[model samples]
Target: MNPDIYKLLIIDDHPIVAEGIAAIASRQKNITCKSITCLKDLLSVIASEQFDMCITDLEFPDTNGFQFIHILQDKLPSCKILIYTMHEEPWVIARLSELNISGAVSKHTDTSELSTAITSIRMGNKYFSEVFATLNKRKSTTEGHKIPELSKREKEVLSYLAEGLSTSQIAALLCLSSNTIQTYRKRLMEKLNAKNVAELVSKGKEIF
Candidate 1:
C-alpha cells in the first residue's frame, strides 16, 4: 500500500451496505476501503492487521454497537472511528466525543459525503453532520442538571466505564477484583442517578 493512501474498513452487518460504502469511498484520492459483515470477522482481521479508520453501524443484532465501538477503539487506538449509522439520538451524539470517536455521518446522507468525511478524518480533522452538533447543543441545554462531586476513585471508574470496559475487564485493568469494580460502578451510577450504562456514560462524559 502507498504510504499516502489511507485504508478504511466498513463494518456493517449487511454485506451490501458495507460494500456499497466501500465502493463509493474507494473512489476518493489517496484512499481505499474494505467492508466486513460482522464483528467476528473484524476480530479475526484485527489480530494481524490495522487500518486508518473503521466505519461502523450501531444497529448490530448480536452485539451492542456502543460496546463494539469501544472494543474497536481499544484494539485500534490509532485508528479513527467514523460512525456510519442511522442512529442520531442525543445520547449517541453526546457520547461520541466521550467514546473518542473521530467522526460520524448519517447513512441517509449522500454517498459523496462519505468520501468527504473519510477525507476530512484522514487529514486529522473530525466530520460530524449538523445533526450531531444540534443534538449535542440540546443535550447541553436541556440536560443541564448537575451531579454531586465524586471522589478520585469514583472518577477513575467513570473514565473506564465511558471507555466501554466490562466489569471484569475494568477490574483486571485496575488490578482489583471484579467485586470491587462492581461496587464502583454501583456507586458511580448512584452518584449520577443513572439507571444503566448508557445513561451513565452519557451523563458522566459531560462531567469528565
Candidate 2:
C-alpha cells in the first residue's frame, strides 16, 4: 500500500452493500478501498494493515457495532469511523455522538450523503444525516422546556446507560474510575427524577 494514498475499509454483512461502498470509494483517485463481511476478517486486516477510515454497519453476527468502533479506535487511534447502517433510533445516534464518532449516514439516506460524510470526516469534521441533524436541533430547542438540560458528562453517562452498559464498562470506556461512574449514575438518576436504572433509561429515551 502506498503511504501517500488514503486507505479505506468497508465492513458490512451484506455483500452488495460492501461492494457498493467500495465502488463509490473507487472513484476517488486518492482513496483505495477494501471490503470485508465479517469481524474475523476485519480484525485480521487491521492487524496487518492501517486504514485512514472505516465504514461499518451497526450490527454484526458476533459483536455489537459500537464495540467494534471501540476496538477499532483502540487499535488505530487515528482512523476515523463512519456508521453506515439502517439503525435510525435516536438513542443510537445520541450514543454515537457521545462517543465522538467522526461521522454517520443511514443506509436509507441519499448516496451522496455517504460521500459527504467521508469527505467531511477526512477533513476532521463531524457529519450526521439530515434527520439526525434535525433531531439534534430539536433537542436543543426543547431543552429545559420539555426536558431538563443535562451536563455534557451527564449526557455521556445517559448515552452509555441507554446502551445497557454497566457502570464499570462505561467507566472503562470513558477512562473514569468506577466510583466516578457511580457518582455520575446517581446524579443522572436524580436529575431525571428516576427511581432506578430502569426508570432512568425510560426517562432518558423520552428526553434524548
How well is each residue in 123-174 modelled by candidate 2, as lDDT tens digits?
Answer: 8898889877776666557544345567898889999989999989999999
Q: Give RMSD to native, each candidate.
A: 9.9, 10.4
Task: After superposing candidate 2 on the true structure, give the runs of residues whose Cα lies further than 4 Å from its correct spot.
Answer: 139-208
Off by over 4 Å in 1: 144-208
Per-prediction TM-score, please? 0.67, 0.66
Q: Which 10-residue window of candidate 1 scores lowest in summed lDDT?
A: 140-149
Clash count in backbone of candidate 2: 0
lDDT of each: 0.77, 0.81
Q: State the lDDT at 115 in candidate 2.
A: 87
